[model samples]
Target chain A: MRVRVLYFGVLKELFACPSEDVEVETGCNVGALRKVFHGRMPHTAWKSMAIAVNQEYAGDEVLLHEGDEVALLPPVSGGAPGNVPWKKIILPSPRTV
Target chain B: MQIAIVREVIDAGSITAALKAGADGAVCVFDGIVRDNTRGRRTLYLDYEAYEEMALNQMRNLAEEAIAKFGVRDIAVVHRLGRLYVGESSVLIAVASAHRGAAFEACRWLIDTLKKTVPIWKKEQFEDGAVWADGEPFPEEIVRG
Candidate 1:
């Protein structure tokens, strides 16, 4: 059973070869799939990325089935008005009243 | 009238085509463009991609939510896929309502909710490197940011 993996955003540039499809063995979990994908693109950062299966977010332990639509999503810096992940957290110093 | 995801660039006319003078008293539109910089990094371009089926469903859901929450009459949302250069439109959402207040609220909610719920993600290309725009897993942080 072959699972179809879709790459998007910056992940597409990771391949460096322009190949969109990745073939994996049946019953391989998301963690294993990440390994294979990272192996292909050694220079690209694969850690701490998000993966969605069949349009729903999935964990690394999720077992993938055949024909499952998997998409690789990297950290989105800014696109919409609200979402921003890497902002510096500022803490105020304590002052004697 | 319909929710669509196309590979071509988005335009204001396409999203506002469903609006009319008498029928639609207020026309609220949200046009998302590729910004020039992110976190002080100069951006070269943006690459947008989505889960076609689910994205359309999510957009439709936003329309319904707006109608119930803000009483918007007609809504049309079109998101672009593929590469978009600087200053190019990437997402277009228009809401037609009987009143201006509802139209404004509905439009704002639609775009805000769409960012959280939609499966679309954008990759920002910069001179030094590129990064996915807020692609984290946690919804709380992403929503607050």
Candidate 2:
């Protein structure tokens, strides 16, 4: 079976090329897919990353299906205001002691 | 005025065209680009997947709210759905207002709300591997207040 894993934000830097399809073995779960990705980039901290299956957030235990559009999202730098579009607000840092 | 998740990269010209006759005193455009690196790894590109219907609806809702709450004149929010290369425009936001302050406030409000309410997820493709963003989870309560 094949799964199309999508990359965005800072996570794209993990691959030589962004946004391509990946071929996985049959009966592979989300965790298994992460293992394959980990093999490609041994330095990646997969545990901190998030996964979404078919546009919905999924856990590592979720099973993968053929043609599943999976995505890997990193921690967003900004906050979600809920009533408006997302914005990045930068504040001044305090002086070091 | 329009909200969509398009496969092609955002067209700046289209955005400008959309806001032409809206009695806008000020127009603000924001372009979100793909950075070259994440953490310690080098990136090749980025891919964005969105719950199309929900995302569009949410974007519209955000726009409407900005107009009502902040008195925005017009707005256009377009985000790329498919693959995007480095430095390509992934997201474009244009907000127009009768005054500059309201326009800025509304634009900020629109983008800030879209991040939380809109069901769009972005994935990162690194040189070593790939990962999924902790995207919007569905089948849950959606509070619009």
lDDT of each: 0.67, 0.63
Over 4 Å off, model 2: A1-97, B135-145
Which pairs of residues have clashing backbones in candidate 1?
A75-B132, A75-B135, A76-B132, A76-B133, A76-B134, A76-B135, A77-B132, A77-B133, A77-B134, A82-B145
lDDT of 1 at A10: 49
Give the interface RMSD of each candidate.
9.7, 11.5
Q: On residues A16-88, what C-alpha lDDT tens digit does candidate 1 reach at each position? A: 4322556677778887887776666534345446677787667777889878888775543323423365322
lDDT of 2 by residue, A1-97 (tens): 8888876554455464557788888888887877677677534334345566786557667889999998764433212111222212111332221
Per-residue CA lDDT of model 1 for B109-142, tens digit only, reads: 8777777667787766667655556544535422
Instruction: Give the best candidate by lDDT.
Output: 1
lDDT of 2 by residue, B1-145 (tens): 8776788757878786778565777887777777676554576666676646546766777788888998887888888876666787777788887788988888877766666556566555666555544433322233100
Clash count per candidate: 10, 39
How far in Å is the alpha carbon of B122 misplaced in model 2? 1.3
